[model samples]
Target: MYHIRASILFCGITFVFNFVRADYLTIKEERSYADPPTGDWVTNGVITPLDQEMRNFYIRNADGVIEVLLNEDVQIGLQTRVQRGGFEERKVEFTIGGKRFSYDLPKNLYVKRMFKDAEAVRKWEERGRRPIMDGKLYLKPIADHLPTPEQPWISGKFIRENGRFIDVQIGREIFQIGTQGHDGQHRFMGLLGQKDIKPFIQQAFVHGKLRGDVFHASELCLRMLEDSKAQDDPKLGRYLFIGDSISGNYDKALRTALKGKLNIYHPPTNCGPVRKGVENIAVVRRMTNRGLVGM
Candidate 1:
């Protein structure tokens, strides 16, 4: 009876120890990938796959399993490897259905939400100016056409009406462009109606060769300045130039032309690319409120 009881106790203790060890291993595997608490899905950033079979990748969470399909003919691009502290990232790109996509997969099987459209995915791969797709329209960044901060005014949307006219909406302003033009030249209207802007438009035309749209924008700015001056606004005399080395040259030329008529303010350091302006817009707005104009 003593031998029988001793054997039974030994088996029970071994079973309990094995069960605890298995539980620890399971928790450790899940923690290694920084996985969300059982059921949550990653909303953004790199998406790592838990497992892959042929062209289908399966992601298993507490809620259910999600399967991503990558066809065989998809062309994969070069991989980028990044390492920071204890974390490691490997990003891969592939093109499918004429659209390119990219995602980063970690060794521990952690991932983020994938791109919803090709344009959003393409923006990440290309540098400098690129077209952005919003619904049915493909719009260019404002900085690509004008010397303005590239964030706020990101191109325009066009709506076709009656098969003869197209209405273009840029920010809050709308303009009508006809499908037909005189002598094969397109006609642009609705931009020349402001009375205060006419003088600046004439001035810009007399000075040099300038694009019609750019001249219109400059005239609009001038009109704003005139209005502010008329109201004795404190921001009327101040200006801020936010750009790179080339813009510095333009700033110097403008300063010489103004000749103490306006106070020009720019960073003592290089401002880099248009992206820097997009990133620090909040700081720019604060400075503008403090009496800086056209920042």
Candidate 2:
């Protein structure tokens, strides 16, 4: 009787353990790669044999890899891998059938998101999240045309024109981009309308210097644009702002700042009549009109 009872208890415990495991799925890497190539991938979302409700799948491939099987051949975001301490998780995004999904993927997995669309890849690099894929850094261009915001200004990363490398500080859903240089100058840029300009400008000058950068400086004020342009590296070819007078005024400043290496291609091939939608400039003008100065 004792032997039989003990055997039954052991079997029961084994069954319970197996049952719990079956409820969850784990996909771990059996191998690792430093730089997994970039491209489009379709995954079989069902990892376990009994996967019925198919909700999430674990991706464990290597340092720079994420194993993802698609649910219905839908497009997905790029996933990249970064050396654990070298890169931080970015809230990269993707969409399937109009439903958006975001993952805090590493740099390596991030590069994978650019597959299928070279343009997408270019934009990702400009965001400055450093995938460094293909053993060399590459910058992809953003879509030629995007709908202008009704408020007449592009917002945040959307204004960069390149979607990949522009890095920004995020606060309460707000994206801030810029940094200070050794010369006591603050450099930054973004897509915001009139309302946001004062707060941003004030923040930069509160410390007693107009060391910040604005993304939507209208070309109408060429002097302002030129002075601001002399603060960055243009040869990097990572990001370039191309527009009309707004962009033109900054042309020489941009060249001087970058040592005459970077060039701005005026009259954006995609968005001509650049002055038509100068919402950012309008905001600047409004700020000036209100007698708010220095930022």
Candidate 3:
């Protein structure tokens, strides 16, 4: 038995990738959180749910399954394992696949990054392969660009010094970036009251149209929603959530989980542990504005 090992230097660190061929051939890759300098991949198959609880599922090619899971770091997006308990199973075709991708694949954002169908695998085999590397802050340009887009859209260091946005630098350009995540909910009745991003470096996709030094993306569920005040949506009617600490306790989460479907508001009067919560119901009604709710 023989193992071939290759080392790549990225950013400032070194990474070792080993290719072992024998009984069962497999490609194992390990690298920093950042993705490609540039490129993409195309795969064909229908993603099937395996175990909703474990966040496990897979794409089927010929027979069995290559069970996959949603990256724990990712909480939102089409690749999310978070069960909607959908009314019906969807026939989806590679939401992130069938397109170009770069080396800076965000495991958090591209939850299905590892999946490759037979045709895609064949393409990989035909194009060729490379070993893994280390230090995501730096990446060497690809000699032969696979998955098209021969040139990297951008390459540089990304850091979240603080707050919800990341500090990014690509060439002479310096930008603060934030990924657009899950859609929020609207709490109608009683409204009122609502993270630092992870830092990395070297090569990654900047989803949004660039503006000054900040990158804002629209739909890639990879952010944490904090607490603050609630605003009603004129499109949807408002909803009043009345309860004690239990209801109040889960109010924020309920709003997030709802994906901003309803305008949810917890009456300030019933927001905490009150000695006489039920009695406060009347107080809440009296406190709120006119015709806001029918409580």
Model 1, 33-102: lDDT tens digits are: 2212111122111112333332322222221222323333321211122123212233334332234445
Cα lDDT of model 3 by residue, 1-295, tens digit: 3344433222223345443423321111221112232122111122333454524333322222223333333222222111121112321122221232212222111001121234543454465532211112212231221222332222245333223333444445444433222222110100100121211100111222223322223212221111112345556644544454453355556568655575554443433333243223321111123323422
Candidate 2 lDDT trough over 10 residues, lowest sum: 214-223
Give the winner by lDDT.
3
Better of 1 and 2 by lDDT: 1
lDDT of each: 0.27, 0.23, 0.28
Better of 2 and 3 by TM-score: 3
Better of 1 and 3 by lDDT: 3
State in Å the error of residue 106, model 2: 15
Off by over 4 Å in 3: 1-149, 161-164, 183-295
Question: Per-residue alpha-carbon lDDT of model 2 for 187-275, expressed as tens digits?
Answer: 12111122222111121110001112211111000001121223334443322333433324554455466555533222122223433
- By summed lDDT, which 10 consecutive residues of candidate 3 come out lowest? 185-194
What's model 2's overall lDDT?
0.23
